[model samples]
Target chain A: MFDIAAVAVTIAIMITMYRAIKGPTIYDRVLAGNAIGTKTVILLVLIGFVHDRPHFLDLAVVYPLINFIATIAFLKYREMGRLD
Target chain B: MIDVMLLLIIVVCAIFALFMKDLLSATIILGIYSFIMATIFTRLNAVDVAFTEASVGAGITSVLMIAALSRTKRYEYHYTKLQRRKPSALFLKVISLLLVIITGAVLVYGTIDMPEFGDPEAPANKHVSPRYIAESEHETSEKNIVTAVLAGYRGYDTLGETTVIFTAGICVILLLRRRINT
Candidate 1:
């Protein structure tokens, strides 16, 4: 069932949180952050099913788009040391 | 069950982020916290709020924090023994601890009178929300009630949000373009 799947994903999120907080390097944290963002998109879609509201997919779609942008920005800033 | 678990993880993330000495790691932990919170909002049927939180919290806020961090030190400064021994620092720490405790106690006290979560007859649910839910489809023809309420009934608020984002983009452009020119 979707509820069971959601609980699993929730556990996965907690695992990623541990990695993000305990990472030894900046790149490790960024990778964990990206992984968390991806999992959130999955959680959002699963939530829509659990709530029986398919329209929530619109929000899910927007989340990944923004997540990608944020990840790219983070990486770019880290490498260049300046956004410009 | 999942909700309770999610809430517990959120608290753990918050505490971990607070104790992190690496600024980037802290920001990433905070982003995970935001992501989980957005999921919780969706579970609570506040899809609009979830959408905003996902975009602003996990996305824009992380990006902004990283950008700011790039301009500053990546690691938090550790006080040397001489600095830690300063009486002024000790006094400031004690005063801040007291202020935090007082503020926390007041906030906890204020929550005692709040209506239970998702109470149908609570003042908020009894107010214009009912009308919005009842008439959103007919008035706005949007399948998502949240979208209808946000883009139709609350046009000015959406406009303000858009304007704010636009202004932020303009400011970033201005600040960054000059560096390229120079």
Candidate 2:
């Protein structure tokens, strides 16, 4: 069931949170944040199915589209020290 | 049950964000917090609010925060003086802690009279939501009551939000504009 899947994802989020918090480098933190974002996208879809409201799937679509840009920007900034 | 899990994660993220020595990592943690918060909003059935939180929190704010971080030192040092607990700093910390505790206590006390969650007879439930849900389709011809309420009935509020964003854009351009020759 979706509830079991959601619980699995929630546990994964907690594990990823540990990585994000205990980061030994900014890159590690960024990767952890990106992983969390990806999980969030999946969780959003799972939540939609669980709630029987597919409209929230639209959010699942939009979240990844933007979060990737953020991770890329983070990497680009770290690499170049400038956004442009 | 899941809300409890998410809320606990949010608390951990906040504490880590506060104590993080690296500013960039703190910003990323904050992004995670915001992203999870959006998930919670979606679970609570506020799709539009969740959309805003995801885009603004995980995307724009993270990018902007990193950009801002470029001009600052990454680490906040707890130097010898701080480690030794300077009297003024100790006093300030105590004051802030007391203020936070008092504020939280006041808020909790204030909620004592609030109706239980999901109570149909709650004041918020007894309010205009009934009318909005029942009449929005007929009044605005919008099938989604949220859209109708935002775009039709509360048009001015949305306009104000637009105006605020526009002003922020203009301010950024004005502050950052530069001449090529210069």
Candidate 3:
């Protein structure tokens, strides 16, 4: 069932969280964190369908834009040592 | 039939995403998982959600991960057992796990009270939702009710969400900039 799929994604997210914590490199952690964000977007959409509320998709759409920009900004700062 | 296939794909992708040793591979698998989920959403008649997932989950998130990966090393050290653990760290992990479980339980209980899927007379369908679904195509000239709700009735919320993302990006830039400078 779709419910089971959601649960599976949750478990995967938890595993990704573990990697984020235990990762030896910052990039690994960043990758794991990105994965978590991606999963969250999907989860939001899935929950919307289960509830029959399309409005939740709005949040899903916006979440990635935020997450992506944040990651890029962080990477740019990390590389160049300056935001400006 | 398609539902079952989508569900199976979701499960497989989740498992692969979790257990994959390569961080890049895991991230890519996670993107596929999100894409599969979006397909499932479309199949459920939640077209807007599907669109959002496709845009945000599969598109932007993957790009961000790849960008971050380019800035640093790709693989993480893997060990069979815990090496060194601070007492405080252990305590924090335990507390977080407990909190997660409690929240999960509450959500499950809430789900039990929800109307069965696709019930016509469900309050969601009967209330403002029906009006939106009925009138959105004409009022907004958008055939998708989800698009109308997001861009029309709740336009302000979408703007606020965009602002939140902008703030988060600014904060990340500030934090990492300082680290690199020092």
Candidate 4:
């Protein structure tokens, strides 16, 4: 069950990778990167369960926090042309 | 299955990032690359390495790259706005390609003799891990082996990492501080 889900998430990651690589605009790339990051977090949890190691959740907990902050920072830089 | 796929995606991201004309897009792709790498580390049962890679690769490095990008031209001047096939540019590209191929070949060659992934009898594992796993809980009282290994067994390494981060923060502050005399 978890193997199937992990495969599905891996496919999703590959699909998202296309948008990130073939971006028509900077926003598209950023959005795709954010999506990839989210999927990676999910993959981590699924992996933890598949491997029967619950501690992987700690790493999953880290992704969204960093991903969201970095995405916001990128957008802020794009709009304001400065991080300050 | 997922492991090989993740590694493939990382390779794709690396190649695309190299060829990207937009610098910001490249930075974002590199973040994704790092994110995938952390997942691979987790898959390899190196959760501690995954944690460090996650924080440093996807977090601090992305933020730093974005900050740096904000202060510079956002496109590759040579490739995006100018003739990319200039003779000198072509020469540089060929030279860099050669360098990359040679470096990659050497790295792969070096890894040919590495013990298979997660081999229990690998020299380092045989030498160090058993002692840590057996004695760490008694010595350090950390039930988590990774915590014991990182904080108890390799305390100086952790201290050095903290010092490196502290020095980086201090340097960033020094570089960005508003001068009173200005």
**Taking the candidates in order, what DockQ does each have?**
0.65, 0.56, 0.07, 0.57
Candidate 1 colliding pairs: none
What TM-score would candidate 4 get against the native? Answer: 0.86
* Candidate 4 error regions (>4 Å): B79-88, B165-182
lDDT (Cα, tens digit) per residue for candidate 3, span B1-182: 44675577678678767776775666656665666677577667776567667656765566566566666656766644354376766798799999989999999998997998998889988898879978899899998777799999899999997786577445445444434334
lDDT of 4 by residue, B1-182 (tens): 88788889988999999898888888899899988998899888888788778767877777788778877888886644356757888899899999989999999999999999778889989988889888989999989988888788789999999897677556444433344554
Find the candidate with the highest DockQ and give its number.
1
- Residue A28's lDDT within candidate 1 is 80
Q: What is the lDDT of residue B144 in candidate 4?
A: 94
Error of 2 at B73 (Å): 1.1
Clash count per candidate: 0, 0, 0, 0
True contacts kept of 4: 0.77
How many clashes show up in model 2? 0
C-alpha lDDT values of all predictions: 0.81, 0.83, 0.67, 0.84
- Could you tell me which residue pairs clash in candidate 4? none
Q: After superposition, how far is residue A8 of candidate 1 from its true place, in Å?
A: 1.0
Better of 1 and 3 by lDDT: 1
The superposed Cα distance between candidate 1 and the true structure at residue B157, in angstroms, equals 2.4
Residue-level lDDT of model 1, residues B1-182, one tens digit each, is 88899899899988989898887778878787888898888888877678778777877777778778888888999999999989999999999999999999999999999999988889999988888888889989998887898799889999999897787656444433426434
Q: Which candidate is the best by lDDT?
A: 4
**RMSD (Cα, Å) of model 3:** 9.6
